[model samples]
Target: MKRSWWKIACVVLLVYTVVGGLLLPVPALRQLQETIRNLYFHVCMWMAMMTVFTVSVVNSIKYLRQLDLRRDIQASEYATTGVVLGLLGYATGIIWASYTWADPNNPAYASFGSIVREPKLIGTAMALLIYFAYFVLRSSITDMDKKARVSAVYNIFAYAMLFPSIWIIPRLVPSLHPGQEGNPALNVNDVDARMRLVFYPAIIGWTLLAVWITSLNVRLAFIKEKNWLNAH
Candidate 1:
């Protein structure tokens, strides 16, 4: 029970987030309106993506240091989970933007063109693409140790690129996305104190879920590679 306490908490907090995010009153901000409710899902999922990617990079560094195949497997699974979360975050963000940022006079396609051009969106796309290339790089190598070492190095590079791609360049340019001045969703000035009740918990819940999924994947990989792992 003690070992599984976080899994329980993940379920509970996600339930609370869904209910509270929909029902709770939000600050009446210009343009955002009721769509501000997406804060719990869209922003939280990005936070979860960032969290998982950080874990992935850390494990990659561990594998590089110790040359452990198990650590390499852990890193790969976590990166896979992070990519999934990033895609979810991207989906939610576009959905929210379609409703909130799209011009009423413009056709859907035209509005989508504008949304796609947004600096923040472009930056995020770049970041996701870099990670996608990481997987492709891994697949190109057939030798196990070479694959692991090369991918680990590339994973670290991908992590470093994330700052410039998603964080720095986006903030430097004018963007339709919020938090141009600082961390998105973290600005106490922009986000209502009331929303934080669900927002913070949502971040935790989503990240815990990512970690849980990665753990299962890691264990499965370990099982599949058990003979080879033992031989090494």
Candidate 2:
């Protein structure tokens, strides 16, 4: 029961999010309409991705402080999981965009060129590429200690760059994404009071789910490493 509590919470919260998110009434606005429901799912994925990445960075920092290879594994697994969630988020965002933001009727919405040029998209891609390179770096090194130490250092540097690439640079460039000039979807007047209830839980639920997935990856990595050490 102790180990299962959070997992139970995860399932319950997500079930609520899916059921209530789809059925909940939202403020009708120009351009958004029924598509606003996607905020619960699509937006939560990105939010959860960020949360997982933050945890990965913290684990990397811990590995550096303690020189613990297990911590390094934790860092790598969490980061890889974060990247997976980010990819999923990006895919869902594209689907959502095609329906509403990319609609031909909306002057601001662009289906193709704008998507490629969008600052957020570009930055997000860059961030994912950096993390992907981390794995490549790890695999190329043969020494376990060297791999752990160098990867932990590189992880910190990559995470530092990630903040600027995904968060800062995107804000400087022109973006159709919300929060540019005060997001209406986030504004209390623009979003209904009821949506906030589901929105917050959805974020927590998605984040917890991401953490759960990361835990599985971390355990598998640990077992593989342990077996390799025993074999040698």
Candidate 3:
């Protein structure tokens, strides 16, 4: 029961996030309006991505110190999960932008062009692409030890790029995206206290769900690695 407590929490919090995000009152703002409910899903996804990536980098550092193949597998799986969550977050952000940023009077192409040029969007895309290259680097290396060593080093670099690309550079540039001046959802003025109730918990729920998925993947990878070793 103790071991499964977080799994139960993940299910419960996600249900609450969905129900409350839909039904709970949000401060009506120009442009965003009801689309503000996306905060629960879109923002939380990015948060979860950051969490898993942090875990991945930590495991990567452990792999470097201990030279454990198991740690390498764990890092890779966590990174994989982070990439998936990052894509989901990016998709949701784009969808939310189409509704909030697009001018009804303007042509669709014009709206798309503006969104495409957004610094935040571009920065995030760069960050994801960098991680994609990490996987490509891993797959290209035929030697197990060499792959693990090189990929672990590259993973650290990928994580280092995340802060500048997604957080720092985006804020430095002129952007229509909110939270440029400070933490987006954490701002009391931007996100109402009522909304914070669901928003914070949603971050926890999504991150816990990500960790759960990564844990399963790591176990499966270990099994495969074990079987291959035994067969040889």
Leading candidate by TM-score: 1
Cα lDDT tens digits, model 3, 85-172, are 9899989997898798888798878888777777767765776787789889999999998999999999897788667666667656
- Give the lDDT ranking, best first: 1, 3, 2
Displacement of residue 92 (Cα, Å) in model 2 is 0.8
Task: Give the candidate order by descending TM-score.
Answer: 1, 3, 2
Pairs in clash, predicted candidate 1 = none
Per-residue lDDT tens digits for candidate 2, residues 85-128, read 88998988887888766757756444587776777677668768
lDDT score of residue 33 within candidate 2: 83
User: Considering lDDT, which of the candidate structures 1 and 2 is the better prediction for this target?
Assistant: 1
Mark the regions of model 1 whose C-alpha exceeds 4 Å error after superposition. Answer: none
Per-residue CA lDDT of model 1 for 1-232, tens digit only, reads 9799999999999999999999988988788889999999999887888788888899999999999999989988988897898889889998898889888798888887767877767766776787789889999999999999999999998788677666567655677888876578887777789999899999999999999999999999999999979998
Total clashes in model 3, counting residue pairs 3 or more apart in sequence or in different chains: 0
By TM-score, how accurate is candidate 2? 0.89
- Predictions in order: lDDT: 0.87, 0.81, 0.86
What is the clash count for each candidate, in the order shown?
0, 0, 0
